[model samples]
Target: MKLRKINKQVWLTEVELDGYNVRGAVICGDKKVVVLDTLSHPRDMETLSTLIQGRALIIVYTHADWDHIWGTGGLIWEDARIIAHTACLERFNTDVPVTLHEKQLVEPARWNGVQLVPPNETFQDEFCLDLGSLTLRFYHLPGHTQDSIVVFLEQYGILFMGDTVETPFPCLEKQSPLFRWITRLQRWESDPGVKTVIPAHGDMGGRKIIQRNIAYLQDLSAGKDPGVFEPMTQFYRETHGANLGFALNASKSDAFKLDASKKNNP
Candidate 1:
């Protein structure tokens, strides 16, 4: 893992594991050091631990996806507090173990010291913590996953969007409300404080990424294809197809119908 300092207090690291390029972040505040999602393996976090040694550590998982939380066991700090959205605990207990078992079948040696470590602190809608000079605000953003959360660094004007916003297009989770997702993206885009947006998988950008995502979602919601707007690699092409499928399926559901009714009536 190579660490690149984004600013004096913020650092970013990208790790390539098993063909997946995962990015993690570190924020060294006045009172505490925050570790933003851990990478794919216990071994991947070894360098991160060395960098933030001898500080009050707080680990925040963007979501309970296996690639993000697999390094939890590697963190040796006894005082470290793991935080995530409330639904992440359920994913850790159910989805994580199943994923681990399935992956172990293919490559057992890579996951040697990994263990299931669920978040000790969780919230439903939002959670804020003051790190003296900086404040971390976590908001529940459901487009990527039900447990997905984005962290906003109040002092730096940076928003860590997790998988809520990605390059080319955003991925969709089952039952994700199209209107709510687009509304949230628009909210972040319009925020004056949010000067930079960082997604979990891709290159970081400004508010334009959020606007692009909104356009794609809007197009899909209106029964139009968004593929012509942006060029996608083979990987994102498949992802786009899946996202379209999810949006189409979600639009027909009762939840979306009710949301549409409320919007139209209001």
Candidate 2:
């Protein structure tokens, strides 16, 4: 419903994806176009692709998260090369047994009939795509997920951090190296060129979002009160209807009260 042009090459559109308001980006280059993430359902991307007909569009998945990459089969562009972190491809191949069952329950009606597609191309640390005048830098940031990565447009200073620090609910249960994740975020926070931050889940902001996420995790690491952690879980569940404690050994709490027991390992 809302659209914001970040730069000459970047356009942010807040679209209704699978009944949830999710953000997607279109990064324009002289010779090609780059799409940040996909929608929750196939029809959503089908609709998005129609709007972007007759353009050189390449799709990149920031991570292998269901919300961002589940609709890959919808956007049918022969020229659009799908790219993601190497680990993400592995994650995509091996579906978590529990999440497979959970996804069956919450996935949108449109996604019910579509076949899923995994990324064809994968990389480890760094990959550069030169779209004539614009250059995209994909860096591996293993925090939210060991497969999690951020897309940095060096020419524009835009960093598309996929689920790294968008929502209050942290999805580190699937993450392999937690400490490295923390370190990656801290280093990004101090990067002077990273002026714009685009998250796969929430509103796009500046470097402040990175700092806020770091603070929340640091508190959690220190064993802070459960009261402070309640909001994050509730916010994610309320928005996505996802159970935050799916695979993790964490407690669940209701948002109705600020009780002492309303905390979980978000």
lDDT of the candidates, in the order given = 0.83, 0.66
Q: Model 2's lDDT to the true fold?
A: 0.66
What digit string (tens of lDDT, one per residue) describes model 1 on residues 172-238? Answer: 8777777777777788999989989998886789989899888988998887788653555667777
Residues 59-111, model 2: lDDT tens digits: 88888767676555677655578888888778755862245446677864534
TM-score of each: 0.93, 0.77
Backbone clashes, candidate 2: 0
Identify the runs in model 2 with alpha carbons over 4 angstroms from their true place.
1-3, 16-20, 96-109, 174-176, 226-233, 237-266
TM-score, cand. 1 vs. native: 0.93
Each candidate's root-mean-square deviation in Å? 2.1, 7.3
